[model samples]
Target: MMRDQAESLRNMVKKNRSVDFQVISITSGKGGVGKTSFTVNLAYILQKMGKNVLILDADLALANVDIVLNEKPKYNLLHLLTGEKNINEIIWSSKYGIKFIPAASGFEELANLPKEQQMFILNSLQDIYYSFDIMLIDTSAGISESVINFCLAADKTVVVTTPDPTAVADSYAICRIISNYNTGNMELGLVVNMTDNEKEAERIYNATNNVIRKFSGKTIKYYGCIRKDEKLSKSIRERFVLTSRYPNSKYSQDLEIVAKAILEGNLPEKKENFWRRILNNWINLKFD
Candidate 1:
């Protein structure tokens, strides 16, 4: 039964090849590093650029994308996984014109869902695979099995970090772990957040890049940085996206540049079926 469903999903992908949706996993090594904020703001900017976007709040436990967006979702991924609802029912459209898949907060079983259930959720996404131009996955922090699997399964992974030494160290650890997997078609990149200036961002990026290259022999593409801005905190308190609240703010402009870089990059054509590749990786995932 599962095999038949998987086959059907593959055909759906092949038929919608022209849509060319890009799936990007945004993650970090430690919590409270502005990872989710970056994800939300980026989606907002992309939508403003006339690109259809969807955010999958992959942080199973403590999921808060909906909270950040100031919108309440009727359903979440847990409902979809448990067969209580379909994918469309769980996806909520934000006022910013972008859509998102909310995850259940404090759900332990969801954090470590069984392999079969994981595939079931991935297979369910086929119905809307071509519905958007970009799918941004906001994965949880740390180098857990779930984090690594989510990063590996995406078309690209953006590792977010700050100028703090501990954050840089943790970012390197996650990058090293992801480097172990032969990411055939996946692009690995880094985003330096909370920098005082461009120079500080470069220093942090170079430091993290040096460690990864020296220890893991993996190259990480630089995706620019976001400087420290006081207005960012104010926007957060107001529960409004920084881009929408202060489009000319430095933080918002910086994210606009990053989004432009991502849009300019050449994503490889889909050589294999999307869901098939994701399920194959999920089934053979290793955590050691």
Candidate 2:
């Protein structure tokens, strides 16, 4: 029976290849760097451009994508893991035309789910893998087991960092960790958040990229930056995404440019499905 089920999943993934879905993991080395906010706004912009988007809140222990959008989710990843609900049941659609899978905040079990449970979640995702043009995973800050696993599974990993020394150092740490496991296939990019101007953004990117190149010999692409804006903080307090609440704001414009850069990447051909690759990575994951 297990063999049959596995074969069925493989066939389903092979047959459903009409749409190409790009899986981008947006992560920060340290917490409170606006990774989640950037993810929500990027999803909104992508959806506005007529591409179906899904935001998977992979933070597990501190999911807040729902809070940013002001939507209450009836189910989360815990429900799927416990067999209380299917993956579809946990997905909530927003008015902005993007769908999201909310995570269980402060749940230790989910934070350290075993390999079998992780495979189950990936299997569930296989059912709806072809339903969107892009799936952005907003991972938790720092280098945890979950963070590394998700970053390895993604087609591209976008490291979000601020101009702070600690944030920049941690961001490079993340790149180094990822480079060790990336095998030269995963595309790595950087986004400088809360910058004063373009020069500051470029300086931060250059400094971080230099360290990464020196240590790992891998290149990190510049995905643009988010300028420091008071309206961004106000939008957060109001529980609304910046793109929707203040479209004409400077922060929103910066996000739009960043989103354009993100979309510029060539979408991987659908010869091999993303879910299959994620499942393979999860199965082969080794913890220290």
Candidate 3:
């Protein structure tokens, strides 16, 4: 009887442990660089690692994260911000363990709201503070004020770019804007996507780092690279995450690495929970 009682107490203790939510924002140097794809896949990978995650399609205009997952968002963040509904009324579940807070379509005026309206929106985000293990924000493509605000508000930012010169330049420009104006302590992560090989991706990352150091005086750390794999496009067309639908694909492996790195954070002393430790072990096992 005493042994059973102890086991019950242990189970209760485990159940009492609260969830920790971290906000991660993914942006790009420009549009058509696959930021939403990265965001969705990364969040899916994190969910696979036994963590509860949230994907906020903060891409006010042309939001496609929902469409990619074949979901129709009934309500979005804007609706909650405008007092039309609460967060619980809008967030949708995914096939993966992650939840989604999609943006309301055709809400152009919400993006250009006055300072009062913007503050209301920012305040509303606080409602889901404890509801997720991580909040992944996939912002719009441009470096507009709204995007800047979302980047600054996020706990961390992951900048997506490709080997193309124009994409590199535009990514660096966004990094400069955040460094100069971000109020939150948002550490930047760089992901070089759609590359043929690691060597080329590394070259692009190194060159961009140099440019940022020289011109912006801010250092952008490397997260990981997503290889150019035909399976990535096919998986998107199928409306499933590469990790889920094409687990053996190179793109999925690369995204898993990047997701692990982001969850680990920058400082060595930054502690991770059981899910993160499981993720680290899983990645190491994959490469082995």
Candidate 4:
């Protein structure tokens, strides 16, 4: 029975290839919850597991994932949105085998793009969307219209929160907001960041789930939790992804599990695409 269920899950992921290409938007109710860190490391982890991943610096207000990787992007999502550059022209390969489209900086007006421009941006983004297996967007924190629009467009929405009471409360609020637009079977995952242990993370997840269940009759499943660690900050200071620079580190190990969970959710059948494998191998070798 367990094997049959696993096989069924894998088949479902294999058959449901749609547009927007599995946008996993990582957002937090408030800032400083390690949202960007989670996004960067998670993208790296997915790449390590042989998946073609694209990390978009969707946090237009304060884009820093490129900086965290100690990289200086030539172009950003804002440039793509404004027709300043093409998508392929702006994408740069990270050393960790993940391709990134950096968000253009110094754009206070980026969040308020006009409707026609917004549609154009979306269409341009969709043009090369299927080129990768996963498109992860590290969105700006908080419940702004920009954040809501990104979440709604994504197939999976991941909300990051810590073990703080206020953080938990805000997470519930975010979940309620997403629930309003999610009609049926859109997978929403939670990442409990900066926790002491799995028990603490589960406690936080349960607490937020309780609030969501009572208030909105919805349940937010956890993708995974990232433990609070000094090495994470240390790696940031060193200007490298923890998974690539410090694979033996605890944070790297946890991120590996998180990556596996994400892959399990998305590619349950474990069928390998020959072209993707060949392409990703070539890309990884070049970047490495």
List, residue by residue over 125-187, the lDDT tens digit for candidate 1.
777867788899999888887778778777788999999989998998898888878456677
Candidate 4 at 221: error in angstroms? 0.6
C-alpha lDDT score of every prediction, in listed order = 0.82, 0.83, 0.72, 0.71
Residue pairs with backbone atoms closer than 3 Å in model 4 (clashes): 10-268, 10-269, 76-102
The TM-scores, one per candidate, come to: 0.91, 0.92, 0.81, 0.82
Q: Which portions of model 3 show Cα errors greater than 4 Å? A: 1-20, 182-184, 267-288
lDDT of 2 by residue, 26-137 (tens): 9999988999999999998888788888899987867899988888889999999889999989999877666999998778877777666765777788778678878999
The stretch of ten residues in a row with the least summed lDDT in candidate 1 is: 279-288
lDDT: the better of candidates 1 and 4: 1
* lDDT per residue (tens digit) for residues 141-194 in model 3: 878766766676566789999888899889878887777664334678789999
- For residue 231, model 3's alpha carbon misses the true position, in angstroms, by 1.4
Better of 1 and 3 by TM-score: 1
Between candidates 2 and 3, name the one with more favorable TM-score.
2
1-288: candidate 4 lDDT, tens digit per residue: 433433343343344344335667788898888888888888887877777888878776477888887888777777676678898988988766678888766677876665445445544554566688888889888897667666755657789998888887888888888777554345677888778999999888888778777877887777788888889888878887887878888888877887677655643122332222222332333335
The best candidate in terms of lDDT: 2
